[model samples]
Target: MSEDAEKIIERLAQDLRAGQFTPGSWLKQVDLQKRYGVGRAPVRKALEALAGRRLIRHEKNRGYSVHPADTEEADQVLDIRVAIETGFAEAICRNAVEADIVELGGLAAEFEKIAINGPFHLLYDANLAFHGALLGCARNPAMVALVADLRMRTSPAPASQWLDRSRIERSAQEHYDMVEAVRTSDAAGLARLIRDHILQRAD
Candidate 1:
């Protein structure tokens, strides 16, 4: 909750998503304190915050560990997201404003730029902002939060394997297509794009 803890939370969350820390690895407070150059209280709070988001686990005696990537679970999460977000995209298309497209376009540009040369954390944050803006056009806040949570469950490690490559350029183009789909009110096209965006793998 403190400023220092908030900073630690962002840093740790970025590393966790970037796969910098191996899945299921123990996260000792002392080690994290040294790594982040913060105190015990901030480290503890950061770990607890991550645990709350299901990014890590807290054990009675063992402090915390990175949440193991569960492939089946990740598949299920992405599956559900495809369903919810496709529907949300259709809803947005039904009554979208020009401003929504403008906002999403800006975020997409930011993401493309960051994904190219920025640190993984910055790219990850930019990606989140792009999706957040896309989700923002929807009617329900609960749906937005649900998509964000499911995304956190997927994290960056699995996706980052390909997303960190030249494939990111392809991904950036998809973002542009998404903007076009929305601008044209192509609901079915938007839905298909959403499904592919979540399910596609880079070859």
Candidate 2:
């Protein structure tokens, strides 16, 4: 893909991640073009790229649409996440600095603050920011990108994951615990926490 196309793909993917488009909703080329302020070619290329990534679905005459939530698929993706993220704990703890811990703590606090009454999107964004920062501590961009793509595949809409305010609050506390685990360089503890956090949702 061309540089322009790559940029468009990232932009469009971010929107998809943010739930800008509902799952199973059709993506019109004209709407995408207006949204990204790009020409037809780049939008088309971006859609094709995303489709290849399994971020969206493509049909013969229907063009592209978001993948609707699938329980089995989501569970499988969550299994992959637990493996990757928990395995990454040691590296993350080794590479994390005070600054990284502080950043994570701040993000965790932000999420906790909004867990009870904030708008769903903001709460979701806060949760994403916290995890993105946590993953960055590992200093593995490739792994981080893969995890992000997997997350989008499993949970196309953030609202679907929130479920209830109590669950959201539990997730918020887990974020703080994750930061603390990093701070203490408790790799094993972090791994357990990561596994529990990912698997608890499926319970």
Candidate 3:
């Protein structure tokens, strides 16, 4: 993909994260073209990319619209995330080096700092980085690809539901626990921690 297309995708993803695009609202190419000051090609490419990730839907007559959020779908996504993260944590526990643990610790510290800050966007990126770091520790290309797809699918959730500082703090603590479990080579503990951590966020 060209740099412009990549930028368009990132901007659209950010808007989706910020709830700028409401569920079921039609996204006209012309409107997006005007909003982003981009040409038709990049806008269409962005929409197609998001649609491929199931973050948006393209209808025969409606052009494109944000995907409707469903509780059942959210539950399923959470379940998948738990399974992937548990395996990731276990892999890290079994094979992670000192440098891997150090990197994970750094990501955890970043997450804590973001939780201390009021702006949720920082928290969001930190959360992504924490998980991305875990996936990096796994060092499995297939697992990383699957986790990336799942992460994109779950990224458009309403920020209002995740605005509680206490909840964010709890998540940060869970990241710490996960890293400790990996450092100690506690595979079972890492798995349990990941399962509980994901389900807690689903609540």
Best by lDDT: 2
What residue runs in model 2 are displaced by over 4 Å at the alpha carbon? Answer: 1-7, 34-37, 60-62
Query: What lDDT score goes with residue 5 in model 2?
Result: 81
Worst 10 contiguous positions by lDDT, candidate 2: 194-203
1-203: candidate 2 lDDT, tens digit per residue: 33488899999998898788977799999998888888899999999999988888899887999888676877898999999999999999999999999999999999988887686668877877899899999999999988988888887667777788788888988998899999999999999999998888521
Candidate 3 lDDT score relative to the true structure: 0.77
Best by TM-score: 2
TM-score of each: 0.77, 0.87, 0.85
For residues 1-203, write the lDDT of model 1, one tens digit per residue.
Answer: 23588989989987776678887789999999889887899999999998988777899887898767766777877888888989888787866698888998998888788667766556556666777777777767898877766676776573564545667777778887888888999989988888898887421
lDDT score at residue 194, model 3, on the 0-100 scale: 77
How big is the positional error of residue 107 in model 1, measured in Å on the Cα after superposition? 3.8
Model 2: residue 142 alpha-carbon error in angstroms: 0.7
The 10-residue segment with the lowest total lDDT in model 1? 155-164
Error of 2 at 47 (Å): 0.6
